[model samples]
Target: MKYIFFVLCWWLAGTLSAQQLKGRVLEAGKDGNVGLPGANVYWLGIPGGVATDVDGNFAIEKRPNGRLIISFVGYASDTLEIGEKDHYIEVVLKAGHQLDEAKVFKRGQTTIMNTKSPVIEQVITGEELCKAACCNLGESFTTNASVDVSYADAVTGAKQIQLLGLNGKYVQMMTENMPNFRGVSVLYGLNYVPGPWMSAISVSKGVGSVTNGYEAIAGQISVDYKKPQGSEKFYVNLYGSDEEMFEFNMNGSIHLNDKWSTALLVHGDWMEKEHSMHHNGFLDMPKKAQYNLMNRWAYKTDAWFVQFGGKFLDENRLGGQKGFREEMRHQIGEGNLYGISINTRRYEGFLKVGYLMPQYENTSMALLVNYTDHDQESYYGGYEYDARQRSLFMNYIYQSIFGNNPNQKFSAGASFNYDNYDEIFGDYKRTENGLVKNTPVNPQREERVGGVFFQYTGTFWTKLTLMAGLRYDYHNLAGGFVTPRFHIAYMPDEMTTLKFSGGKGRRYAAVLAENAYLLASGRSVNVAGQLLSGRPGALKNLDMEEAWNFGVLLNRKFLLFDRLLNINLDYYRTDFSHQVVADNETRPGMINFYNLDGDSYSNCYQVEIRYELIPRFDIMGAYRYNDARITYSAPEGLRRVRTPLQSRYKGLINLSYYTNMKKWQFDFTTQFNGPGRLPGGNQQFESFQLMNAQVTKFFRKWSIYAGCENIGDFTQKHPIIAADAPWSVDFDASRIWGPIHGRKFYVGLRFGFDRD
Candidate 1:
């Protein structure tokens, strides 16, 4: 039978797997610990081999039964003979740490490992991404706790991220640290970035450089695409979900002779199912399609670095009553009717150049320019919303030292930004007795913004660092604003660091994007005044949402049971001067929007730890707590609302087992989320708990992973919102919390290659 043939093939592949001739790679040091990462470890004259990671851990397969070569840059090469009995051995490299993960730094732009910033920074390297199969870079957060991903309104099939307990818009998204997220891209941009092409993702929480322009209320997430000069090959991936969605990811890198290299990354998604099968008379999902493309090139030499890249994205979605058809674009329910369609296109490009100064050991000057064009068109039950956005961004980062000490580094930078926005919320009417009538209400808006910033950092006392930054914004709509940030770090010992940050930040909030679910019911926005000036039929009254944030954090590392253990904790708080609140209790057909009349704020606390228990075994855990609220003018003059619903306590555990006895490995991981508050529409949804787990197996040249989400199938027993007037204007989709979907299982496989 075919099943037996398949089993035979699998067994043959596993049986042929190269026998283990393991070895330990170590750094020649005083304590006999610390592995040399990036060491060129391989079998002598073998056809293939690999280097060690920073932890000096590596597994090389397909090597013949013989001797091997150990070589690294700036270090003497050594040869070691191996016999069949020599399953494992230990190698100690000479103290020339150059071969031991020595980072490269030449000027303005550098990797986090080489950065001299006083703030804490972490990098998610490409190699780590390859450890699993994922569709987009946004999905890469599976193992990272600093960033949280959430479902974008259930029907839209979109996902947004959270950082420091704040929304994605507040965290600031960038391509290589250059501004890009805005307009339509703000809706589904997470899907636009394919996972295969990213080289690394850098996360800088707390206050960053003023040069980045102060958009980050909690942190900054910079996406770094793979550079063209040094890239590995062509990749193609196919991913599918139980919900009947398919995703395609591909990236190709080519060398045009010696001086030129180019790369193109693309992501495509499609779904055939229109109904969610729950058949609540509401579309469980929508017919949707999306495409994204990015082309990048980089050139580098000993003295100069130049990189240029461009990106484009297009997407469409249609949703409504279960039986609704796109051709009719209309429907009527026993109680009411609704239909929705959305289309968007976005384009962006950037260029950066860096010139290293030969006079200074670590000095460089850089110039950068970023430009974007974004637009969107959509219809929510025949009420159309059209929008366009254009922006230009520029920044410079220069670094040098006042003294001969290379560690005594100083950094400074400036930035410029511009934005032009135009939006129109189409007219609307109502049908009370199954009769249609037109009520003319056209709302439009236009606005512009300009900003400038300066930032610097320095180190003193060999154990202290300070970073202070400032920024000013000149608006064509809301007048002016200022942002100031400061950070301090004190290291009592090499293993522990106490870091604190204080910053004042302000953002002109775009309410709809921050909470699009509120309008999922086709509720028109009712404004008191103008949001932006100089437009016909524009909302005459609106104001910017402003706030200030401060944070303190500490991290410690130790050697437990002869292995590494890491712990990190942070606390952050924000105070709002002006916040936009949606008052739905007043009118069901529309919502009230106004600046805060009282107090509004949020608090966040988090902790994480990771430890290696023994060879091939490790464990990790994370927890987060968020407290947020908003105050606004009500019929009662002022009222406060707790943040919609969210989990207050979250935890995760992971374990892995591998050994030299067999050519196999197993990995298991579990995540747990605790209950929190929920909102009430006609009625409130109850808080709930969630637990999920996955298991993976590695064999020969292939890897396999399978998992079940919502393992307990926990969900609110009651509908999220009550008073579902299918015939009236009283409907709300924003009152959602906890997992709405039940338990589901998934599986995946992966194989890769690289050529030299």
Candidate 2:
């Protein structure tokens, strides 16, 4: 079977190679030629186009006798005729008409859909990020309809995301195309990246390419940070909220020479005040303090490029009853108050190098290396948990045209992943016959994997595109496996596009770390059979989880009332072959882990529309439906039931308007959440609505914005069961369905200096 699949992939790749046209666009500067980023390049009558990269580099399918057009803001548009012999070209653009006392106005879309790539992708720009109080990555998805962000539990204040009706772990997370936020960091890693340091975010639906890894079962999300060589010289942001939360951020860039540049980013935030707005004895939010820092350096030459960076973070959190403090973590008893405390310190570093081959046209090779060390200590009520992780990753790739055919391109790569973990978890205090006891479980593990992959891309007639990839990996623990992915895109006209994608993905489950929030409850932890009978200190020998995903998308654009209107529709389905299930409903007062023995699947559908109501006024609306189920062991054998705490449907509407001079902006958003079944599928939650709004005023060199969240002040009732008794078996904080806190207001200021 493997040999037949390999032969089929190779045969499909040999049919589509032609020729490609490559070039660079630059602006005529006083000192020298400056590369212009974000320039639009397309054929004169083509259906799709592409934008230049950060270095003003672009590649397109070569068509004989076709006219190519390039244009950018504040620059004159240029058109040129292409010939069969031309493979590379360079063009310089001059400034557009200038008036004596008039200003040139330019506006760009806050969100964009890529029409050229084979994969379905959406880009969120920095302008859209400012619509709300985006203090961290967890809060940046307020305007997006596809990704849903929610709190994991009521006490820890930890946030998690859902994509295609699946958990965040199934969705691969990346920073600048590198894998991150794995293992122990999955719970709180969303809070590490400061919002002020982001430039853009890209979200791709369905399974991604195999070059990254075999872990993207649902989708992929990649974040792009502000570059060191950007036009910004210095920037700062200050924020304060109604809950007495204060934050400060600053970043600056410096150029050492013509070939070297560096940037420094710093962030600090604290919330020392404790509040129990519900008067339920338990605090609504955690008291927290965090400090983060990063430094990056970049070097570029004609044929070589190098970039290196390092980051450090330190954070502390305290939460529980209203009067509980961090100092009372060890004094939990009949007379003492219940408390929760967590402390974390992390370090990360990475290096990337790329080289362009002068001997071959459109050929390049690159290498990437990354290392991370994370340590955490925490205690929930009478339970204690401590963990440490060390991970290293490396990838190398070679890219070039196939047999001098510009229309056919291929890339081959190899990757290595290593991980070491140490964990200790148990209850420090146990009550038995009016006496207290102690029980602890310690488990350690190390993993190593090496993989190689090949990917081929082919384009025909500038309307149809096909991409296929295959990868094989050998794991020390799981033996060997193969992953295959395929994608197809077709454009029927200038305003219509259709895409289909399918792929297979696999990964090992990190049970204890991923479900750390369950510790806040009084439930006991257990394993299904004799997996931990003899080797009590060794980790469970569970099967690696595997799944297949398939999806289809349709995008159309047309004129309505003489204005452009866009509509998008998509559907995806995921089927699991092997899964490690976390069964909390089968047995009351106990959390059990076991291997799956039946069916598990998820189906998702979404529709989105964007239009302009009036000049400078834009509106967007979206709706999504989900059907997810899992099989679990019950008192009467096995049964399939709906997943707990997952909403059946969601609706969103967003409105934005700005003044003519762009000095003032107003934004409003509304969301409707449908009810879902609670644990055991015995009861259903009630539907609710939420509203948010913001207003911003811009000055010459700074801006001020204010916003309010949960304008309706709608919150879930009794989010925590048996809140009055923390040591009782009925106490559970993991069954969260909606907001735990009430309305909140915040104000912020941003100042920046532009480079000449």
Give the candidate number with the greatest lDDT: 2
Q: How accurate is candidate 1 locally (lDDT)?
A: 0.63
**On a 0 to 100 scale, what is the lDDT of residue 254 in model 2?**
92
lDDT of model 1 at residue 309? 89
Task: Note each model's CA RMSD in angstroms.
Answer: 11.4, 6.4
Candidate 2, 1-756: lDDT as tens digits: 884465346434433433568888887744358766566677776544545644566666678889988776446678899998888888887754322223322234577777667888887878789988899888999999999989999899888889999988888888888888888888898898899989888888889988888899989988888888763689999999999999999999998888899999999999999978877789887899999999999988878889999999999989989889777877766667777887999999999999999999989999989899999999888878899989998999888988888779998999999988898886744446431535467788888999999999999997899989999999898999999999998875445677899999898887888888888887877665532222347666788999999998877665455345678888899999998888877888788888888999999999899887775678999999999999998778999988889899999999998885567999999998998989976699988999999999987678999999999999888878888888777888889989999999999999988665
Q: What C-alpha lDDT, on a 0 to 100 scale, does residue 130 get in candidate 2? A: 92
Clashing pairs in 1: 335-726, 335-727, 336-726, 529-540, 529-541, 530-539, 530-540, 530-541, 530-542
**What's each prediction's clash count?**
9, 5
lDDT of 1 by residue, 1-756 (tens): 784465345434333333445555776633235665556555654433544543565445434566777765434456787765665677877644332233221110111221224565666766445434456766677666667776656556567787766667777788887877754467677777778768788887765767777677767788888776555466666666676777777777887765667888878888878654343556656788888898988776667778898988888888766656566544444444566677888898999998999877788889889998888776665455666777788888787776786645555666667766666654334545552423433444445556666555667776788877777877777888888888888765444566778787656665554444555654556666432122346454457766787886666555454344567777788887766666655455666677777887778887778665654454667777777776656555566766555566566665544443323445454556655545433244444555555555645334566666667777543322432453345555444455445676666655443334
